[model samples]
Target: MKKPELLVTPKSVEHIEDLISSGADAFIIGEQQFGLRLAGEFSLKQVNEATKVIHAANKKVYVAVNALFHNDRLEALDEYLMELQRIGVDSIVFGDPAVLMAVRELNITIPLHWNPETTATNWFQANYWAERGAKRAVLARELSLDEIIEIKENSQPEIEVQIHGMTCMFQSKRKLLGNYFLFRKEAMEIENRKENKNMFLHDKERKNKYPIYEDLNGTHIFSPNDMCLIDELTELFEAGIDSLKFDGILQSDDYITTVTNLYRQAIDAYFDQGEEAYEALKDDLLEKIEVIQPPLRPLDTGFIFKETVY
Candidate 1:
């Protein structure tokens, strides 16, 4: 099989065209933010439209139904998903078993890449889904680089891990943040004071609020350290992993340059100079933020190291 390519998804039709224009291996169209902000409407029409344009340019597209949905919302998801299938989505990312089973029931036939939110670790579980027609599993974010390598070696399925992006620090359930914006609307205003780092509070519905910290000093509010494996390309390839995924739904031009360039250089070094070249590029692989007008957080490699270096 060919080596995996880098993917950057614009958050919506309004902001992603520039990103699509910039060169990337593919576009994971229809990110989580697309419909929620569209004034009481949500649909995969954006992905459908994006796929047509991207196909014309000869780039790949993956639609992400990548959110944690309540049981009440499954029916709506099913209907939208049918449209995705009819539109000829290259691949669709999903985590809910109900969603998975529903899609399969219709024999949609498109590849279903398991989203990490479902949190299925262990190779056997991955293969179990593969037999059921899942094309790949986007491994859990909590995994170490070694664990990721192990998953690739042991899992019978093709494994893809996030190579770069912001992450939620909590366990993968993502159910904890069920706190609604309607309940207390004040959390967004507190910014990041010491006493108010996490401003969200519990509401009458019994759902706890997700605090939005304004840590002026660094990345805050459920931000995971960015994963930049630019120079580590050979190690990931040698580990037998299939894809190196990048996170963030349409953000900035700098995001495009910093991420894609690093991987491009890393992949080239792998074939040209091998490990020695890779080692040299590893040092100072990150570019200084110059000015984090809002001041971003320092990075965390998460559990990627052999031991928990972070």
Candidate 2:
């Protein structure tokens, strides 16, 4: 059984040490101007400091340069990527070609992780980016378990998957929440929208309230059920994924620590004792996860088990 690297997005530079201790093998953190919907943003100086800390622990740190860039943002990008390279970031997660161009221009040696999200569903797309210098591909969350395994088997780039946490369903580059408040003639600060988790969108027919919020990039909505795959770790390990990401977005530090530890244990158990022992522990793991996760956000395997998602 291959042991995959366990990745998580830390809430802050301060949380890096704790997450490292809790068994995260790599971290994804970035600034809001360059990254979209990140769990936490760090100043360039803070990112330098973070890289040092992660290196000291013999773990990896990846900066998210994954935003859909505009013209203004591109001007500072080359400098940002250069600084990240100088500070020794393990790799960068990016969705834009501008970042690739900037990396080429600066001659930065940092590996690129292509994460175009929904478009990263097939082995061909992963290989296309691999040929262009991307070292890894963060597979789209919409992929089924079998789809993911097939990609890993066929793709040239190392495969990464989001196996846990809140999965975003929609993102728009507009202040949808703020515009709604304005339409109703209510007052609310546009910048404070991300903090307002109490706000949600109810599907008229389905009656499911999907969590919604806004930040620097735009307004975003998440799946009603959070993704949980503790029970499926054995299959993913068998598939030989390069990394497993546990998104810490919209989650507390305690929750992050608890869940990371659980997954870490599950990963070790599966490799150390094999599938039967891992299966025996799955029930206890889910029981613990349910206690920490928000009561309203039920846990499901997301699109992993679904036959058809469209």
lDDT per model, in order? 0.59, 0.88
RMSD per candidate (Å) reads 7.3, 1.5
TM-score for candidate 1, residues paired by index: 0.74
Task: For each candidate, give its TM-score against the true structure.
Answer: 0.74, 0.96
Identify the runs in model 1 with alpha carbons over 4 angstroms from their true place: 14-17, 20-22, 31-43, 171-221, 249-253, 280-285, 288-294, 306-310
Which residue runs does candidate 2 get wrong by more than 4 Å?
Answer: 188-197
Tens digits of per-residue lDDT, candidate 2, 90-194, equal: 999998988988889889898999998878889999999999999999999998899999999999999999999988889899989889878887765554554
lDDT for 236 in candidate 2 is 89
Candidate 1's residue-wise lDDT over 98-216, tens digit each?
A: 76777877777778887754266667778887887788887877777777777788777678877766555443332222233224664453332333333443344743233333221
Q: Which candidate has the highest lDDT of all?
A: 2
